[model samples]
Target chain A: MKLPKKVKINEVVLRDGLQLEAKILTLDEKKKIFDQLVKAAVQTIEFGSFVHPKLVPQMANSGELVELISENPNDVKLIALIPNLKGAKNAREKGVKNLNFVFSASDTHNEQNVQKSTKDSLSELKEILSYCKEQDICLSVSIATTFGCPFEGEVKKERIYWILEQLTSLDLETITLADTTGMANPQQVYDLITELTNKFPHQLFNLHFHNTRGMGLANMMAAMQAGVTSFDASLGGLGGCPFAPGATGNICTEDVVHMLHSMGIETDLSLDELLIASKTLQQLVGHETPSYVLKAGPYDRKYSIPTKK
Target chain B: MKLPKKVKINEVVLRDGLQLEAKILTLDEKKKIFDQLVKAAVQTIEFGSFVHPKLVPQMANSGELVELISENPNDVKLIALIPNLKGAKNAREKGVKNLNFVFSASDTHNEQNVQKSTKDSLSELKEILSYCKEQDICLSVSIATTFGCPFEGEVKKERIYWILEQLTSLDLETITLADTTGMANPQQVYDLITELTNKFPHQLFNLHFHNTRGMGLANMMAAMQAGVTSFDASLGGLGGCPFAPGATGNICTEDVVHMLHSMGIETDLSLDELLIASKTLQQLVGHETPSYVLKAGPYDRKYSIPTKK
Candidate 1:
């Protein structure tokens, strides 16, 4: 099980991370983070979600953020989340070329999170899918809570396969399985990703993991062995599931990249720039971030031994 | 690779966890934690170390701890750390049946940590080995910094294999490879454990990992897939390398058990009891412990959705 020579990491700090925070960053603050992430050589970025402002106030500035960034497709690609046709229309209006749509594999979580049943959410996705095609936007579907759900104890693999099957019918080429609550174990991750990749050989897959149970990196490693090469990580470990209580942040991007590079795996991202970006984010949030690499720098940086008494 | 149905976990909270703390636990406090661990069905417990009180005052009471524990072979086996021939003599006099002796794989770490050269440490280990054999005691040798060293940067696998060859000649059956600085990544863990296990088919190997870089559980899983079952965990993630500054605690016992049980692997240990024991340790240490399971209960516990407002 040799890992791929390079893995693509999509930074999601501005969207998934800030969505769960109590304080919202100003327009300039958001732009500073975006520029720093670009400086760090993150090729793909998910910066905003076009949800209703009333539902998630922290993300109220999504449209403005989308309008502010330069439309340079060669240097970097930007992705925004859209829940339904209305959000998709808003994203298109704001010229978001790349978009992510999420539907939970667990019915209870789907309804609670997006206010729609699984079947109805897929139906709603059809409208958004048509809108994406007409607007020439790249759409990537994410199956949230694909491993396990808080309300629904253990999510069956059949549910995920069925959802993926529906997305396959919709002609979506790329899909992501999100461990929204971080209930994934290594064996479960390995088995399920192996099955999914084998069953859908033509479709590209990405993994989004939460570090709630401290299995985030372990699960990512399992997915890597099972042939996954794209992962979504947050700068400074800054995201949590809004619906799941006690859920921690996403796997820290700097931590993941540091480990990967140390193992001779290539990411083409700079750990030093990522640390500087993480520090800037910490200042904006006015709190210490949860980055492991930021706290304990790269593995090569040795701490001087405390002087013997 | 399918993991073994049952895994053996050796709890090192009382010994490894407390030894790094600024405060020390009293004899009664230590006994209480030990009794709870017994009730929780931990088969092997490393209670304390037989080092000089002047060097590590926290473990000065190893002999007393050994004397206090009941001599029931069926209930729980007690293991203690022995640094030199003098510590081995004290452990033998106090009736410790199992002993662990550590030698750093890097010469610099060995010299800085124990104030001995690698050759000198191995020579000292030979005397301790003879004493343990004469006393009819089981001995496990730990190769510290098997993956990387703080001072030495990266440790070569050849060095670890050479050290293991020396211990193998001593007729020892089990050896634990310790990632003392949390410097191991998943690939290195998988490759090394697989090669070591293949080379020494009959020898038992255990992993002692630190969670400093957040790779502890990930490394544990890699070892598990490579056919290594036994692991060393500290309750509430209690221990770290005292000589390695900025290193964190060992992998948390409760968190590991939680993930294993969720994956349908049998550990035969109670998560609830471990949590209770973790809380007790937190109170005794006068600070919140670092166990993820203690923060978030088992994954099956449901979280109510936050109101949309």
Candidate 2:
């Protein structure tokens, strides 16, 4: 059970977490959550996504939210999710310095998510890369459905390798292998990550998992065992894939931090402040979020002894 | 990770799962769930507890349920939980062949749960052992709060070792280290189990975990890595500690089997049948259970590709 001494969490509650919710959070609401995240010492955050207003109404205010938060003098890296070159340009114009380009590894899922084949998405990534370079913006890539796909099912390691080979040659800050629908098992995560890290030792990889099947933390443990230190998690475990049927929230940020801190792995994030942010997110969502730490508190929490009757 | 080729599951839904529900199930309904568990090819089941009827109204029918189900000619081992010699005698009167004596490793939790200190419980175990021997009933023991205690906090490994030292001398079928409040983390589980297995090489040990903190599956993975082959899981993730505040369900049976089967580990249980049993439990309880596989199917389930517009 050898694990890393420290790990990095990239909070994505604002973008991926709120994208599927019916209630559209105003810029003020998003800013409130942003301030809480900053108070929690979140090093990097996916603030929002640059998508069409009609396509994803909840994230239509991504540009405005990013613009409002970018003015703060802080070192917290603010990223916006982009599906194509237009999304990247939109985020850049709004002063989002960091952009994450996402596309599914499976052709069927890729087509369903972004209306383009994996090959076409790769071609578009080239243009997005050149555009980001011209705009002096940092870029990353998220290969969704790297483990399995709802439509196609059982995505192969070769497909992930193929996608990574194309993206690795580009000037990207990181490459995230996402279990988009929470279809990944621990063994598969360990094997794929072990191979990927060994083949490309210098490439920085991030893992994004969902707790849809109750394997989120286990998969993260496997990824850590395979030497991955960066992860994408949503506060209060708020998020779901619209295309993936019965999809649940992403691996929760508070729960992940709880596990890591329990196991003596440092994340540099304040658990108490994270719980405050999680409570705020739950209030904003108007529903119970799938956050275990919020409900159960930390493992070290002590209760008073019951007096004998 | 090195995992066993085959793992054994001791289903505890009948006893622990139902004990917490406000809606007490009828004898016929309990039989239905038992039949479904048998249909799923479950080898071991904790049928019910022999506590006082008034203490646990939900399990008051334990005597009747055991009498009715034990008559069926099957190889499935039905075990009853007992907190003291009185409960053991009561279970034996109903013709239960297997009995599991439960006490907590933490003195405060033991006192809260059973109105006795840990030392008193160990002393009572001697009488229960003799009674079981006289009745020719096979017996095991479950040590609650082996990881941590809500009241005392951080139940030390020295305490666990001391408890096991007393129990290992007795003729018990197996011993279970239970995270009664879901406070056990993976590193602690791995380190403790590894050390225990090394020290007590001949003792058969089982792990009981709760998903209260979302570390159930991860802790199970860590235990498996430490060479444990048997576990206690509840169907639909049912069960919680009545005394442990904010306790959630146990590690879900269907979810555990789903993960093991996905990792190429065998449990000799039909996942589809388990899902059916889980669905029955959910309906019988008239609420949603915290089952991941029940809500999101197995990982191998494929969805049809949507036609392009």
Candidate 3:
């Protein structure tokens, strides 16, 4: 199957990559990385999540970060994740333009994660959606654990379709299906993406994959084959859910970009610039990052010939 | 596209796994692992390589290992790797019933690896083929770097076709195209496998992939989409050429089997038994393996709900 010429890459390294990290990056450090991403021509960046600080202290600076970089010097879309109406109010007060609201397709996961049932979370999302419309703020909703649930296991596709039905009623422009614990397979990815795109022809669909089972790239390729043109990736594969066991990180941004560009698909992000951004992250983390392209250079980097001893 | 009902997998960890390892497993250790594979219902296992001990000290006991396991107690195909006419003679004397010969599609890699030009190695292979025919032994040849070379950047499809033209003259039953340096992408794998399988309808084509750039499982899925069934995998993701820089281990056997089985595709090998074999290898190597299945278990493995503190 032929893929689209250009795919939109929404980088989530700061929000998703740092949420589960032990060493919470300082505000200055976060801003420096944001500047680098803007310089690298990254169109969209998920800066931070507006969750309770007691729950996720790493993202405690979400409001201030949005306040600092909300100017959008390069026309970059800075997205702040809001968990509920309270988080949405906090972001709007801080002048955050674009906001992402997240809920899980699994009722059990939604209850465990947000202390509310899936129905209650949808009600809360509707409140946030109405508030965003009144404030003239751009909004998108993401369904976590869309593929599988760590507690329930093998999440049914009907759950996802029902959620999509609810979001479509709100006339939302975009929706993202996230493999929160990385429990997705290629066949499921292709089948679901095809079904969703066919069912909602007007809404933009994005895919968020974690590399928990080493099927990240394979799943991405399958999605591309199903005509998906938007993806979420982490700069250094930095993020994981604190509650999920053995959830390593998100799909490395540079690695997938390298593969896509090699296949003659455009990601609109420079591998060289991404590597530099990844290297800067290594210094903050005081070790090497978990990126394949960062570890091994681009595909065309030739190997040197060995001299005879 | 629908995949085949079952795919044939050849386990190559015993030979390719230990060849580049710093740890040398004894004969009894090898036998114990072989017994576990047999218990796992593995139909084929590459026991060892009959190469010069001076070059690869780890494979010095190949002939002895073959002599010990050549009885076919479980009806498994015990294959050995032979580099030249001398190694083939060594394997034949040891009562090995099945053998695989190695060469490279890239001329520079062929020269660096076996100290012979491509034409010269083909000539040498002709000699080995004659000997195998006279001895009534089964044979398969692997053309390494069929995708890309560490020394030479990209290998042309024309080069592979030419090699096939030469091998078809001998009426070989099977030929394996190996991505030696893990430099292959999904598009290249899909296009090449589709073309070759269509051109050579009579011969069985096997694909060998390395997880160097984390594209192993992706490439395998693409090959399956192209209608190829046979594959070569390593246990616990062990082995890489000492001469090929930046080349990592082969695709993990348990991981691939887990993915295939989850998709309703049968591989005829038990995942639980493969994990036991992976554990045995870890004990010998004194570290955790690089396998995702060994770490995360299978997809059906359920997680419990979190308790309130």
* Maximum-TM-score candidate: 2
Descending-lDDT candidate ranking: 2, 1, 3
After best superposition, candidate 2 residue B149: deviation in angstroms? 0.6
- What is the alpha-carbon lDDT of model 2 when measured against the actual structure? 0.91
Ranking by DockQ: 2, 1, 3
lDDT of 1 by residue, B1-309 (tens): 468888889999988888888888899889888887887889999999988898788999888887888564447988888777788888888888888888799988888778898879999988888888888988888888898988879888888888888787687746889988788988899899889878877778889998887888888888888888899999999887554444568999998999889888888899889989999899888787668778767778887766756
B146-175 in candidate 2: lDDT tens per residue? 999988888989888899889898999999
- Top candidate on DockQ is 2
Order of candidates by TM-score, top first? 2, 3, 1
| Candidate 2 lDDT score at position A33 | 94
- TM-scores of all predicted structures: 0.95, 0.98, 0.96
lDDT of each residue in A1-309, candidate 1, tens digit only: 478899999999999888888888988899998888888889998989998898788889988987887564336888999888888888888888988998888889989878899899999888888888888998889898898998878899988888888787676746889998888888999999889878877777889998888888888988898889999999988888654545568999998998899789999899899999999999998887667778766778765655668
> CA lDDT of B307 in candidate 3?
92
- State chain A's TM-score for model 3: 0.97
Q: What are the DockQ scores of the candidates, in order?
A: 0.56, 0.68, 0.54
Candidate 3: residue B27 lDDT (0-100): 90
lDDT of each: 0.85, 0.91, 0.85
Candidate 2 structure quality by residue, lDDT tens digits, A256-287:
99999999999999999999999998998788
Rounded to one decimal, what is candidate 3's iRMSD?
Answer: 2.3
Q: What clash count goes with each model?
A: 0, 0, 1
